[model samples]
Target chain A: MIILIDDNPIDTFIQTKALELGGYRGRIEAFRSAEKALDYFQGISTSAIEADSFILLDIRIPSMNGFEFLDALQRLDKEVVSTFPVYFLSSSLDLEDRQRANTYPNVVGFLEKPLTRHVVAGLPGIRKAAS
Target chain B: MQISIFARKSDFQEVTHIKGLLKEWSPKVFQYGETARVGKLTREIVILYKPQLTEELIRIAAEVRILSPSCYLLVIGEGIPGMTLFHAQVNCALQLSEIGRIPELIHELKARAERITSDGGSMAMQELQEKNKELEKINFELDRFVYSASHDLRSPLTSVLGLLYLLREEVKAEGAQRYVSLMEESILKLDNIIRDIVAYSRNNRAGLQIEEIQLPELISDVEPGLRYLETGEITVSGCVKVKAAFPFSSDRNRLVTILNNLISNSIKYRHPARLPEIELNLERNGQHIVLVVSDNGIGIKEYHLEKIFDMFYRTSDHSTGSGLGLYIVRETIKKLGGTVRVESAVNQGTKFTITLPLAYA
Candidate 1:
């Protein structure tokens, strides 16, 4: 199952639907807020976070923003945050954001917004080394 | 939306029973809250029996408010004289005393339950929904993380193997140097994986140790590390100034790391045409010392703009980066109570605006 923490319901719907259309081989769950996602992070075991598990996080949120969420997680078990991969799937290409996400141990990569078939196809090997 | 209900203090006993039933059996109407209390509440309740004292009625009303807000009472002993114009005007539903008389009253009560507490129940449900969403977020992050780690890391690692394969060639070609350079990218990726592990796991741990230092001095000190970079010509337009808040603030090593990440990234992503145009503007804004690093490079695509700081994120342009460099820069900046921003477009160039708080360790 893949978790997506995006504020826009339309984006989640389109992406999940597209993934479905694309025959995305995994279950997809979407969240509109980062606070709830963070709460989930608190509940989950690092082991429960599968290698194929991915986080599609957006930086902008009302209560607890993406970066703030990360800051909160930093207080948590590093293994939980870092062991699973997180990718910044946001419309923002800000240099500082990229740097922050890249430097973060939990964050595995950064991708532009709008998950496309081309991006998916190019990403076939994203799960090759987790084991 | 706010709702108000007025019942008599004397009617509190029967109302409590109805309220509990409403909470237990019919969650649809009057929620568990906005319910009932017989004593010590601010609102007035109808008094059907004894203890109709204004204070007692007030207390019961207050209790009712604390418990069930949609539940207020009237103090009706012999008559309804004390009933306020509004209280007198309250919409009356089923009279509890006659609750047993009408079977239809049951249905009406059920419907009233739905209407009364519908918004409150919805609020609770919304919180639950939010939690479910969070569960989904963590799960997706896990998938993407593994995906990026596997693919991004594997490519370079495989390249290393390919280099090894070429090295195995009995008659090595002169392209060995080129192959080694190419292979360097993978080694960097591996090193990046290790560094990220350290940073991510230890983000909250206090690692700051501040010491006052000049920016020019810091840059000059780091220049020797650039012996490998051939930035033959460059222009730093304005007088590079020096001003830091801490007499001695921040982790020196981390500062160096941040600078190196920015400078190296600038050098690495420079436009093939521009080759070497880099600018670093340091200035102050209200509470932050902003470091603006602009590069005349190929520039980032609009799509990849937001995620440049994410780990292992090399644009489709095939730029080779440790990916963790920018991420670490961000983590360090945040630890120091600073923030970073960027502006870029394909072919136009890219600008990174970083704001560091004036206060330091």
Candidate 2:
């Protein structure tokens, strides 16, 4: 399962295309807001979220940003947050952002924009699926 | 050299004695009840120390310092045992017994006044330098703000462009295709404007890196981008003659930015009936390199000639430009120790002559 969180619909669409092109046949879920994604996570049982599930999160968004969402998720269930691999997908090429993203224990990678098929395939645990 | 004394009304007798001794000086006296009125004065300050109201005296002294930092604070009272700390904060602390020696006190006051005047001038200068540093920091932050703002704006536009690319393949209807192409054009225009803004901010933030620039190659690099934006053939003349003096020393990026903006502007505001023509001429003039970009486009009005290089000053309401192109061009030119001037008539043509110092000083 892949959970994509980006406020922009066009970004989400592009990411979906990129993911499909990268040959990921799993279920893909998208939320325009971090709050909505949190709500979706809260409604589901901890065990329902697979260990292989990936979260592609954008850092900048209205109300609850990517870091705030991660903080909220940690409070909800630290075990569940630790289980899934999270990747910060941001348009910002700021070094501060990359350093901050790296501080998160579950954050697998910090990827720049236009999330291409090659970038999707390069994710740590998803490499086998891409191959 | 006006001196004002502040003290409790109960200490009036002591204050009066001091005033009578220095009768020639005519010091203004303020009762503790008139502390609020003390703030209105713009004279050298004197606080008559009352041991009973030590806290109040310190507070008033602090207030006076705020009102005028250079205002000399003269403390006149018996030197109380624990008042050394309080005395340290003031310009001069004097004993009542010292008041009887008028000539000595006046000499000390004269010396203190001179010290305060000199110290105040330096302090004010230091404050101005600190303020200038703070303003420079704020200007840098503003540049960063423009960079981030344009970056964020570009993100959404990138998404729109991506979606449009996908939609071109999915949408088979002729009308839908036409709409998609129009949407693409608008998005591209917006993208270019955002790029220009980001480039402008980057120019302000980044330091100059002087390098040798190949004239024909630089023009060719800018040509494709402008050609992509225009519908008609852009006939670029005078590149061959300029290419021989191939390597001109300057900040290449800024020079390219100036040329790009001028070329883009020429393409953007081209006269509908006339095919767009841009003439480029570069010549070595004394210690400077003179580059002229003359375009037969919809020229500026006579009144707008002065304001065309000002930020956000667009001539026509129908124009879709961000109004930052010319301003950025002029600014970048200025940063490179260059000067740009424009000449235009409404229906005729516009010519911009830029003279850049050959070396980065």
| Native interface contacts kept by each candidate, as a fraction | 0.00, 0.21
Candidate 2 chain B — worst ten consecutive residues by lDDT sum? Answer: B63-72
Q: CA lDDT of each candidate?
A: 0.55, 0.70
lDDT string, candidate 2, A12-130, tens digits: 98999878766777789999999999999888877787657889999888899999998888888747755567888776534345657778888877665656555566565567665
Report model 1's interface C-alpha RMSD after superposition on the true interface residues: 17.5
Candidate 1's residue-wise lDDT over B124-172, tens digit each? 4455578889988876576456444544444334334333433433335
Choose the strongest candidate by TM-score. 2
Candidate that would win on DockQ? 2
Per-model TM values vs. the true structure: 0.36, 0.47
lDDT of 2 by residue, B1-361 (tens): 4556666777788778766766666777777666566445544446443523444555544322221221234443222221222333444434455555543555565565456445564554465578999999998788667757766877877677667756765788999999999998898778777767676776777788888888876775454334335332343332212423447888766776888888878777778788767777888888999888888888888888899899988878446778888899989998998999999876678999999997776
